[model samples]
Target: MPNEMNKKQQEIKEKMQQQKYQSKVDNVTPTPPLLKNICWAFVVGGLICTLGQLFTDYFLGLDLPKKEASACATAVLVFLGAFFTGIGVYDDLGKRAGAGSIVPITGFANSIVAPAMEFKREGYVFGVGAKMFVIAGPVLVYGMVTAFIIGLIYWIRQ
Candidate 1:
């Protein structure tokens, strides 16, 4: 009767049992303190925000309009994201900081640059650089498309 179970069902049950036993054995007598997580969250969040602020300042210093400065900040973040992505350092930072590395302009930069870099490695003329726009291209197109649609809707409403 017990061996009458289906193969898949038996596998699932075994996996579940293994997980239950592992959880018990893996349990440490002394768990790490909560203060570490809180401190990490603050430090990571603050560093990310600080970088954003720095970019804002840099853009303003260039005599750009406020809106323009904001755009510049985004661009800078995307660029940094792409660059760090190329260097492979951002991934580690992302792991350590969690949202800290990702919730910023730098993350955007990383997103755009990383793919392109990957393509470039395949072939300079045909690789990552050419494919680099794969990620940001859609974002740019979507932004423009949405803006146009919104403007059209507003105009029609007016």
Candidate 2:
């Protein structure tokens, strides 16, 4: 009797497997709109660059030194990035805008602050401070290391 039950179960399992395979073969996934995504990313990225340019121009119009004005504009942008991330608006923007929202200085700021804010519930010391660099720390370290290696290469070549 147990042998009969075992044989029935194996037949049922084979039928189930065949149905699953047939379902997969019948299902067709539609292609994503890659070109549309690219265009939107370009438009949004251009808009971000335009905003930064406007900020720098505005600071220059105020008679600030060129270098100082650039620094000030960057500072404001970074602050805005961190603020938006803290308020949870930046995440939505990033999702919709894709690379348009990232690939900028503001995005770097957002990356750092988002992790810190996420861990804040753990406590200030272990939470915010410790996790603040979780995302950005490796980037920072690698950037410096790459720069040093490049400098050494240049120096050696000379």
Candidate 3:
């Protein structure tokens, strides 16, 4: 009975020590400013979308059809994203804007180009070409597969 009692006391003491350590760690840890992060994300994401809209408008003004204008705008945004990423501007923006810079098509472009750029020093064929799709490859594959399945289902329903 004394042995069991001593064992229980040891267990309780260990738990108390763990709780004390956890409290100290929690006190030292800095909390993130959630509201500030959300605001930055919202503003940056909005600006990217607005830029896409402006590109679409400019293309439409040039007499392109609505579909073509939208496509051109997307292409422009992708090119801009890749260009900004290549020049290292996009990484800085991403740091400040967080997910704001990631939810847009520009983010998709960054995803593709960033990996390629990182591997470029290893040579074009083995490095850039191989790693270019490291981040975006799975996304593209799943997206295409999902689209094909959806189309097939729709056709069957019809």
Candidate 4:
């Protein structure tokens, strides 16, 4: 009975020490500015969208149909995203804009290019080409799967 009691006490003492340590760490950790981050995300995301719209408008003015214009705009945005990522500007933008830089099609381009660039030193076949899809592969897979399921459901309803 005495050993059991001592073990329980020791456990409680250890838990208390852990809590004290956690409290100290919490006190030392600086809190992030939530509102500021949100604002930056909103602004940056908006700008990217605006840029896409501008591209679409430019294509539209060239007598392209709306669908084609939109597609061209998306391609342009993706190219810009990959280009910026290659030049390292996207990383800096990502740091400052956070999810703002991640929620757009450009972000998707960055996700693919970034890993490929990182692994480029390993060679084109084993590194850049393979790792290019590492981050985006699952997203594409799930997206396609979800689309197929949803399409099936819609067809059934029809």
Alpha-carbon TM-score of each model against the true structure: 0.55, 0.75, 0.79, 0.84
Which of the two candidates, 3 or 4, achieves a greater lDDT against the reference?
4
Better of 2 and 3 by lDDT: 3
Candidate 4 local lDDT, 48-135, one digit each (tens): 9999999999999999999999999999999999999999999999998999999999999999999999999999999998889999
Say which candidate scores most in lDDT.
4
Q: Report the poorest 10 consecutive residues by lDDT, candidate 4.
A: 31-40
- The 10-residue segment of model 2 with minimum total lDDT is 25-34
Tens digits of per-residue lDDT for model 3 on 35-134?
Answer: 9989999999999999999999999999999999999999999999999999999999998899999989999999999999899999999999999999
Worst-scoring 10-residue span by lDDT in model 1: 28-37
* Candidate 3 ranges beyond 4 A from true positions: 1-29
Which candidate wins on TM-score? 4
Task: For residues 1-158, write the lDDT of model 2, one tens digit per residue.
Answer: 99999999999999999999988877875655888778877887788778888999999999999999999889988998899998999898888677887877788899999989889899999999999999889889999999999999999999
lDDT of 1 by residue, 1-158 (tens): 55766877989999999999989877855775557755665697687778878988998999999999988877776777777787799878776666566556676676677776667668966786677777778877998999999999999999
Global fold similarity of model 3 (TM-score): 0.79
Task: Rank candidates, lDDT, best first.
Answer: 4, 3, 2, 1
For each of the candidates, give the backbone clash count: 14, 0, 0, 0
Q: Using TM-score as the measure, what is the rank order of every candidate, best first?
A: 4, 3, 2, 1
TM-score of model 1 vs. true structure = 0.55
| CA lDDT of every candidate | 0.76, 0.88, 0.96, 0.97
